[model samples]
Target: MNFERRNLSDDQLLDLYKRLLKPRLIEEKMLILIRQGKVSKWFSGIGQEAISCGITAVLGKDEYILPMHRNLGVFTGRDIPLYRLFSQWQGKAAGFTKGRDRSFHFGTQEYKIIGMISHLGPQMGVADGIALANKLKKNGKVTAVFTGEGATSEGDFHEALNIAAVWDLPVLFIIENNGYGLSTPTNEQYRCENLADKGVGYGMEAHILDGNNILEIYNELSEIVESMRTNPRPVLIEFKTFRMRGHEEASGTKYVPQELMDMWAEKDPVDNFRRYLLKQNILRQDKDDQWREEIRKEIDDNLLIANTEADIKATYEQEVGDVYAPYDFEEIKPGSETENIRFVDAISQGLRQSFERHENLVIMGQDIAEYGGAFKITDGFVDLFGKDRIKNTPICESAVVSAGMGLSINGYKSIVEMQFADFVSTGFNPIVNYLAKVHYRWGENADVVVRMPCGGGTQAGPFHSQTNEAWFTKTPGLKVVYPAFPYDAKGLLTASINDPNPVMFFEHKLLYRSIYQDVPTNYYTLPLGQAAVLREGKDVTIVAFGAAVHWALETLDKNPEISADLIDLRTLQPLDKDTVYKSIKKTNKVIILQEDSLFGGIASDIAAMITEDCFEYLDGPVRRVASLDTPIPFTKALEDQYLAKGRFEETLKELVAY
Candidate 1:
């Protein structure tokens, strides 16, 4: 589509030039600061300033902006204080992240600018989520998400685009084609002729703009933003710009060709805009020089202020300590009464209780609202709590998790669902980058709970039935919980919702319909990092979680002589080492049981921990009972043998005999 070129007024042209120049100065100053040891590192938005500034000029100030690392120009144009930016670079307490985040990861909720996540394409999904929220709230605000051409190659980018286009959300995706992804050039990264053309695959409008030309960038984006305000459809704008500097301060441009560098330098966005302003007589030589001097002085002053700010240090002591909002534990009498309740009903009751207590709690996932989730864990929630609290999201896993992170960061308790646990692979980037690292990286709490139905049972094949909790337990900052019984599931899920950090709540699909112990209808929570001792014995400690927990219990019932203490590890991250030690001390033996594959499973970690912490207490060698290292088979007989459940019983009996 051809963009109409309207003659810009002299004043308007000068304003565009001024906007571009500010970012240019900031980039230049940041580079100097790195050399001078004032800042640790910096990402330069040198040749791409026009595209960054142009998008901000068109987008409403109240609208949300989820920018990538190299979009300093966009934040500057949005009036984010330079001092705060400098402070973040200096790792000072006054920084946007309170000295927790790196310079490029700055964010301010008050400015309607969500933080810039360092991960490549996950932020694109987050931007779509913000737009979804705006659409739901009828806030009439657009979301402008920015990313590099290399990011388009990521699965999250496609996921975000697909959902945004399908929903027709008011989201403007800006793809900055800066020629290269670090050392890899565009040709090697993607085969598409133009990045904007990829939007056609999603059935969305796409535009290509001369990113070096500030007027062209501004006019095209302005029209798109205006259209989105009314029609509220997703649009993709590919900015054909170039990165004049290396990817990060640490990266040297020796790999970049001198000829290509020279070519891009000649098309510098700041210089191009300045020349346009001078040609139009909108900015005289004297006024331009004076404005440059003033901006330079302002930056210098901000740098000085940032350097003087206090340093923010994160200590391991604080890391283990509780960081979430404190809640007074209500003194509700414990019930000895046992009433059989369906696992799904227990989940619904637990969620209803938590939502009733915590007004800020929100639930979102595919078919979670009307259909009440694929497993019906959220059945009748929409009818009970209304659509606002129980939101049905488009089929976008990345967007679902990213939006949960966004909502959690904004002081809301968010529970994101993946229809099946296997689909979590689609949202892995956000889970690893944003959810797992947000706490330690930014010193900000990400109180989000991600629920997925996992474990293999019944006739569901390899694709449908695979326990992937091990993949997440390996990630730091995320608390992985797999509750065996309905009561523990309800209690642990409630605790996860109230916790400060992100949690991966795994529910075994096989247990959803199974009748288990009675769950209280009243408010209840099981403390994280605490394990339940289901059965007390002296033969061995059978440590298990989720579906394996039930198997261990059954094995204990079958082999009464093989007295073993069953420790259900409710939360994996903060493994209840004390309980495990106690069990080991009592039984003088240890056996880790799990349904996941033996390779790198939670059992291996638990075995290592027992060896390290309770090795001397052990009477015999520590053993593990886990599934064989193979994909889940489709047939029931094959799957039963593959899961290694019988091995668990044999291992327990052997431990008692030994």
Candidate 2:
């Protein structure tokens, strides 16, 4: 696999030409199809195929590549069936995504290719995750992720580079500096003299190359990738190239000065490579013409077959069902062994148990290693499990979450912790858009649990204390779990880890050390999407979760004369609707409680569901008792006044009397 420019045989040189020419032919036909209204929009790599084909040329079969929209050569170079790829582009059921996504937005696990989302930069983090798995497994596999010059501006890009550098993961951060990000010129994108220069600041090895020269790109990547397989460190390479066409076919290159377009056109990768092969006495003109004709015929024949494939509507039910992985809701009974511990200790025990039981399970977060964690839940975990499984991360939520997604797809279980629940906003795109939608889009499982220490009561103000469960519950492919007690926390956290879908495990900071319960010492799991009816009564049904469940318990204790049914919803997404409905049937009245602000909280959605489904069983309106729609205050007085716990008793009294 060692590649030397002078040692390359005539056949090897011809193979490189064919690889470069295939994508060129495909792009030309695709642009014509777009004009004829037979195809959708296209991001043409008309002049920039060398970077894709060159890097892929030297890649090992087990190594992974995360390609951007413009890098169509990565797909064709991997020898993916042209017919199925055409089907994917045409939104057919035979496509990789089952037509859920279009163009290069889909990934096929079978190909070792992780596709890019529209956001571009997050895939950089995903590459780190895949490389992290390779490092952990002691496998020599490497990962290369592609991006445009413009995407380097993203915090995700910086974060990903820093993490990869710190961990010394075997990742190739390739930037195709096409001189423009859409319409913005490269000079305007950053002030740096070269994109490769940014890599030096991160203390990573950096290289710059003439991207149009196919042989140069191939030689450089071959040596770098080979070295990475043995020595395993991240390297950033900037391929100096230009986008010959508009960003896409529709956005005509009118913004470009004709002079610039003509300049790059003369340096076209495919054309120059073809001419170079001729001058080297390797490929005759007739052979080159024959190869181009054969490629066009291959494309035309496959496109015809793809056009005849089933439409997306033919697989409507399957597409809808794939929004979440198939899951069983069976509840497991706890073993005889038990221990009296706080909620925080229960979480630590659950994590320890998971690590002991599952060899692939790993946890990553900021200061979770020797520092334990902000909450000390992972204290002493490094000593028990070692630093490999218990990883300390940079203050980069986006990359950390993306790494979790990468690991889950690569046959590993990952747990990512947000320092505080509020900090998850920085990583929200990958959690909601990428991880949540990955299963639905491509039938790939994202078996990662994001541990969020959420909720108010510590007077930590707006940034530190916020209940954001509604943010993920509404996202289709995610599972949401908010446990109330130590027993449920351990059980549900274990259950969340075992689930094949992405689960958001929210542990209320207030309940961390405040609640003490006898939890099972052995590993056990409670059913997710099932409510726990802590107390049963006939007058009213009080639905709550997280710390709000404690508020309901306290309120019910104070009103001994009032008969109330307290339902603790352990999981929020698959929502135990049947349990809530059954409780409503008996009680004939309902009240939803939450620590989040009232307007856009989960309580509003639950209240609406009750009104819609339990209208006939209701004796009165379904009321919602939640915090006021305002930022959490720093002072204890205003904080208590703004939280739902302050008014829970009075609201319960009014609802029961009504």
The most accurate candidate by TM-score is 2
- Checking candidate 2 for backbone clashes, the offending pairs are none
Q: Which ten residues in a row have the lowest lDDT in candidate 2?
A: 1-10
Reference-based lDDT, residue 113, model 2: 88
lDDT for model 1, on a 0 to 1 scale? 0.80
- For model 2, residues 201-292, the per-residue Cα lDDT tens digits are 99999999888888888877888899999999999999999998888888877888899988888888888877777776788999988988
Instruction: Please tell me which predicted candidate would have the highest lDDT against the true structure.
Output: 2
Residue-wise C-alpha lDDT for candidate 1, range 270-318, written one tens digit per residue: 7766766667666799999999999999998988887777666777766
